[model samples]
Target: GATPSIDRFDPDLTIRGLLEIWRRNASLKD
Candidate 1:
């Protein structure tokens, strides 16, 4: 079986990383 990425074990960090990526994308649309 394949192992999941570390982010799956640390949801807060995953959410934060996602938010950061979303912010960058939002800024790019401006």
Candidate 2:
């Protein structure tokens, strides 16, 4: 996965990375 596991990264970083990926994918679909 593009994002690191929660065990590797802080919770905030993991969440931010996931959200970033989601935004990128959403943009691509537009």
Candidate 3:
């Protein structure tokens, strides 16, 4: 099922997603 566009605007989810990406990048830098 396609996720609703409104979910992208959620602050908590957005922050979590950004944190996940940042963690991945940080790990790769090590």
- Provide the overall lDDT of each model, using Cα atoms, as 2-decimal numbers: 0.80, 0.84, 0.83
Best by TM-score: 1
Please identify which of the two predictions, 1 or 3, would achieve the higher lDDT against the true structure.
3
Candidate 2 overall Cα lDDT vs. reference? 0.84
Residue pairs whose backbone atoms clash in candidate 3: none
Using lDDT as the yardstick, the better of models 1 and 2 is 2
lDDT at 6, model 2: 54
Candidate ordering by lDDT (highest first): 2, 3, 1
The per-candidate count of clashes, in order, stands at: 0, 0, 0
> Arrange candidates by TM-score, highest first: which order?
1, 2, 3
Q: Write the per-residue lDDT of candidate 1 for residues 1-30, one digit (tens) a residue.
A: 223776356788878878999999999999
- Off-target runs (Cα >4 Å) in candidate 3 are 1-8
Scored against the true structure, residue 17 in model 1 reaches a CA lDDT of 79
lDDT of 3 by residue, 1-30 (tens): 346664757788888888999999999999
Worst 10 residues of 1 by lDDT: 1-10
